[model samples]
Target: MDVIKGLLVLACAWGFSAHSAVNMQQEAKNISDLSQSMTGSKEALNTNVISPLSGGGSLKTFDRKEDFSFSIGTCSASEVFLKILTQPQSSGRLRLLAIEQDTSLDGNLDKFINVNMDADMVCSNGIMQCTNVDDFSTCSSFKWSAASDRTVGLTRVGMSELGGCYCISGKCGNALAWRNLKQVLTDVAGGISASLAAVNPYYTMSGVTVEGTQATVTGGNAQCATGSVTDLVSTTDPKKLASYQNDPNKMKQDSQTETASSWAYQAIQSGSLNPQESSEIRRCSEVRQPIIDSAKLSDIITLDSGTGGVGYCGADCIMLTLGTVGDNYWNSPCGEFGAAARFFIKDYKRIKSAVLEKAIFDDWIQILLNGNYIWSGPYNNWTGQAIPGQCELSTSWNINPNVSFKHLFNKNGVAEFKMRVMVADAGEGYAFARLTADLSCKDTKTDTIANSCSVYQNDPECTLLEERVDGVLTFSSGAITGLNPLPQSKTISQDSCQITIQRPWFNKNRTYRCNVKTQSDLTKAIARSEKIKTSTTAKDYQDIQFKNGGIVGDSGTLNFDNLPTVQPCVQACKVRKPVYPDVALDGVDKGVVNPTHYDVTYKECSVGVCPLSSGEELVQACQCTNDFAEATAIMQIMRNAGQDMICSTGIEKPL
Candidate 1:
């Protein structure tokens, strides 16, 4: 390689310095003349030719140990430079043998001839070098001596300069090696075609294109150029790219479907069409409800009675004094027990806002709607026991309309207002409460009508006469005209002229009738008297006729049926039942802490749809479970203390 480089540098220097003044056109003509003399042809030699294998211009190759020789001129002083340009089209190094001559006449080389080999030559001082091969900026010169005969030899070998693999016959660098290896492996394996069949497609080069210095090979199903052996191995097989065995999207879809199917199956097994209410006993219980601030309250109404023998005494005065009373304090019939008094607000839909104006009680009194706690006060401590020496206690609270109506009112628009009084050691039991609210109602109406018509015509005229009648019919009341009457004519020779008007009526439930006026014109009448016949018929109007505007009909009554009045509360509550879950305690053990002591359990009777004030056999009203109630109370306390907590269904926070 070093020797080749030194010789290339020397040849380039000699080419530029020796032929710096040579005429390019004259040299080309001389070469053409020499070529014609040697081949005995008139045409010029086409030196600018591209090789099929190398895809480069003026490419020539020779095998190793082959004798190669080319002659330019026969011992001429006027030297001609036979410029040859060589470029390797594949992965290999190019080699050129220096020209030699046998001047001693002993069949041995004695002198070397200088030849120009560069496409572009630059000269500085006395040295010449090739700057770029593609730029043909200067022509090269070849010097021939009369003392020696010129000879040239070129050799090309399939070997890469980068020391990996070399391309052969315009093929990819490793293609031939891969083929030979595959054949050897096939022979060793007793010609098992299946072992190499999968890899055979990738090794086959479909085609190659050489553009300038770059060579692109299309292989591996001929879709794209396989840049390297690694690329071919990675991209050829589609099975290695993807698999559906652990797709997360498919797994998630399957899990959701299974959950829905399980819920549906459970609903079916429990004999309930709705999955949420399946195998669950529903009863009225205290549950938190969100308040809507947009609803305004007006038209205040006061209640006078409540359950558990509690009644209104007067303004701001309510008492549960059914058993015995002393010193303005009522005693419970049972000692050391709890008594509950409930006030039902049946007009819950119309009532927008409710407020407990005042509540006076001895012992401990807790006011609630359904099961939601409204107010509890004057307790001895956090245990909710009655405070000693506190015989009379009073506290007022405002009720949230949304919370009150959601749990208290069933689908039938009835609400239960309750208050529980606990007496410890049977001292005294007193309950006094007052509630005021607002109610509203609205009404609507509609009407419809159907009308039809029938007409009878009679005409008496026995003459050759032509009669034409024309007029417009008008209605008295605002009624939609079904059809209008058109003009009619007839020619009566011997019989009477008769005209019938039918299928004309109005379409509203109103006292109205169509009045018709006819003006008969006689044309070409000869001894004839034509009597035209016409009549009007309607549902609630007397039939009449006139020549001009006048009273031509009698009025009758048109009755309209009114639709039932719609209460605003009913419309609001109807859509509420399907979405809201039934207000019921979860279970005895899960909801209430001490069920035996409090005498509270999950109600087994029907809920929302049950009738009001019925016995326990039909429907039962109950309080919310202790755990949920306590959780709500604690959350409320935390919010009041500026540490707000998020409240959700079926979620309990430790107090």
Candidate 2:
């Protein structure tokens, strides 16, 4: 064998071994451990809690001023607003707020402390400890220490010192924890802290914008003005700054600044913006950023590279093998290709009506069979040859002319193939088959079939029960009309079963059923070979919920059943008129449009918040504020931050 072939063989072996060794418990623990400290040592900032995968035994701690610089970055404003979700793993009083350049909190003991913590401690033996950790009324402190020199000469009292704006206490227990915090803090702050935008004057705009610019904040009352500060260097990584995954259904876009600012607002207002909480938020942000970014890619291009499994055959890599449809003798043949058979053939009646339309399907199948693709299996050549019982070829279709599959992947430990082909004897002139041995499913509790038949195969259901009885005789009137063949089944592991549809369009129709099944359930099988988009996590759903104003109901209610009014802020901000070629539709050139020559009766300026229910209707009788653009952008940020807005007054007016 050639050197390339030899290398491929070795790589495939290692991949299989690695995959076989993956422990689900370890994976969950890895994520869970990120939020809590495992080290038995005292809570000091800057302690590195290395994960087991990194070969470290120490528990990771939050960064401190000793180890990191606490100064905000060049993107910071005079005041920064933040919110924090408190987890109850190891509840303790947040000590110093170290303005660190990095996360190491050693020796930078003169950091900003909770005003309450600072007051309660009384400096016994140079050690500060909380006298009453539960009484957080005095904890609200967003002040720079006098030692820091920023406020040395200023006589202004901090917002926390003012009456009415009290500190937030304890962990929030709302199922929609993010939403509840808004009310909890508002009531706790006595409406003094309505939102982060309202409270924090030194809000940083770093890594918040699509382009990392501070959004224009025009005429809103400054709740706690910290005065202007030049661009400071943020100690934390921008990627791990905040949870940016907002509900696309509610928020206009993923504004990172809004998320970061909102979180900071909550933290400061709630008096939870300390070293420990900051570090935890950073960790959670790091864990969640990739998942959110992946979900945003327009076409899941990373997974669906538009190539097939044959790419593995790269002339030198011949250890990989592919198989044809109906090859029952091909035992676990490394990799195989399959698709819904309906793709290849056309019914006579539909064909005669739209031969041109059916031709598109033929083109797609031709690309699949002719495309240079590789199978997803071990890179170490677990199996040899390009196709079973055939010589290695870049085009697998050259070896087996009449078969095609959408993608190739391993099912269980065995290579399961899906075939889409035009069969002369089949009634629909097409046949779809799942050509993989049915290894006895040991744990039916965790095993689930993809049930793709409802959408792709045009069957009532795709069930193993039907698969078992496919050829069984069905006598409906003591006469045999035809056999009821079982539809194809895509087995979904228990891990992939956590959902109700995400991404609104995924629930719209069956346009991408086959791809969704392959990506979600058969992720591991195809991930190495293809860019399979992973499923969203429970945290993703919460982040999305919080982005979309967080499922509001009657205050203090347990359920999200009673939703708030769907205010179409986008509609409220749009300018309604007829079309004009050279004129901008945003309340400008309204009188310039030729009414008689308009394509649509009412030309809509799709600018602001449009309710999902109204579709495209223009919000009637709402007026724009003087700072409409700024208000619109800020409102989008606030709405994305889960702040409830009463939009009956239009974009300019804030309720």
Candidate 3:
């Protein structure tokens, strides 16, 4: 937008065509209007102070006697030159008076003449008058501002000129004694016109590309010969791009991703506790000693063989199902336990060849077969195939309820035998084994079994029993009834009859742990954590531009080298239709009344003087603007792609 005003004249001419008589007529009208505007120049001049006139008002003086002086008629000098270019010294009533070289002076052409003036004029609101003489009012108001070297231009130009003389019409108002301002204006204009004529096609038609288009001067006063305009384009320098190496947003994303991944990996490698384990610990803490903690027993009971048949096992092998009402018992009788199994395989041949090995037995409670303790069940081989071959092991044992279960302690808590029931040659088999227990106990405090069982223990009717497995005394059975009946029975199905054991297990280490490997939900948690840990690696998105060899600042400054070169983008211009439709010549209307096709190359530069004759200000300005735009676009893309690097501290709030 800033470069538009300077090229208006060139643009209009370049867009014209000779057959466009209507446009030419409008251009002529435009020149007429410009001339009419300048016609008031004489009336616009400031005339309160006497301007030394040479006969017909010529500024040139020929003799020393002809050197003039005047008095500012009625107004103060300050009002005449309201904008003082220098510090006020109150030197004299004369607003401006000086001596300068006079070519016509005697002896030498360098001889000088003196011009003086006094504040005796009344000049206000575009009218000037001497003390008693007639008023001098011919030109419009003269406006100026103090610029470099204390020089000023007229009207709007006066507000912006740094140091120069410019004339649009041939004259520059009245030439005062300060300098030959009028001549300077004329010479500058002449030089500009001559220079433009040689290179600016807008003033010449020698290389005209369009048949109907006509090139004209700025005021549109005259048309030039056919000619070509200069070709120029805009470009950005990459080295000037700003740096973003230390942006906080990018760093935060990177940090989050890294930390999350590490935590996820750790969670996967190690295991975590389940809520049920904590509940068991809390419940056991309140109960009395001598209690068989079923919760502790469960923790140590891991699968040794079989899937979904009898014991605890992996899902792919055997999954254990606790029995209803009593299997997941927190506290159970020390020596009484039960087991049932569900085989996963339905193959007739596989089930027939399947073998059921010893799965679970009490460590303290002993089962006697002919006075020998039985710590495990003998191998039972099946011969018939059946789906989910459910089986239960029933073992009856003698009880000494007078003894508290706390006396029966194994370091690992679990009193179970490993079971591996599988078909000999078949890879598929149901080997899962599960256990259940009736955690019922009766206090003998009121009817002490100790006093009554003492007599029976010494009798020959009750036989003491024991068993040895792997050199460990795993089971022992004893009878404590004075008569042929056991102590009053306690059933586990009645909750009110059960005792609450509240002691935590001594060995907290799990026989089998569950984690991300066992649960799909935990796997997703790990993925989310990893996302956070990897976010920061792409912190400095600006660095990506460097891969393309673009020069950007490694520091906070800018680099302009290696900037991309955008080709001159073309656009559709007004289609010049023929005045009268006719036959075609080269696929176009070429009748006498039809216009010829015109093709002229032009550039819509973003900055700088088009035709690029001089200064680099436009070039630099355009480069800076374009580079910043590109950087912004790239950053937005990153944000949209979910690579936002903005640092966050608390939970993200909803918009």
TM-score of 1: 0.19
lDDT, candidate 2, 557-624, per-residue tens:
11222223343532333333344455456755566565333332222222233322223335343333
Q: Which candidate, 1 or 3, would have the higher TM-score against the true structure?
A: 1
Q: Which 10 residues in a row give candidate 2 its minimum summed lDDT?
A: 281-290
Clashes of each: 3, 67, 75
Model 1 steric clash pairs: 81-142, 307-342, 461-496
- TM-score of every model versus the real structure: 0.19, 0.14, 0.12
Tens digit per residue, CA lDDT, model 3, 1-655:
3224223322333454445646556666566444433332333122211242212232322222344533321111111111111111132111223222112212122422232332211111111112322222221222222232222222321111111212111121221212222222222223223223333212211221111111111211111112111111111211111111336675556556656656654664474445333211110011112323222223333433322224433322222432222122323332233332222222111111112222332122222212222222222222222213323223321222221121221233223322222221211111112232223343332321112223334544433343221111222343211111001112222222454221111111111111222323444334333333333131211111123544332211122232334435422122222233455666754444636443332222322323222221222221212346867988888776553444375554332
Model 3 ranges with Cα > 4 A deviation: 21-432, 435-655
Which tens-of-lDDT digit does each residue in 371-445 have in candidate 1? 666555454232344434443333222222222223344333223455455443334433333333232122112
| RMSD (CA, Å), each prediction | 57.4, 39.6, 47.9
Best by lDDT: 1
Minimal lDDT window, size 10, model 3: 79-88
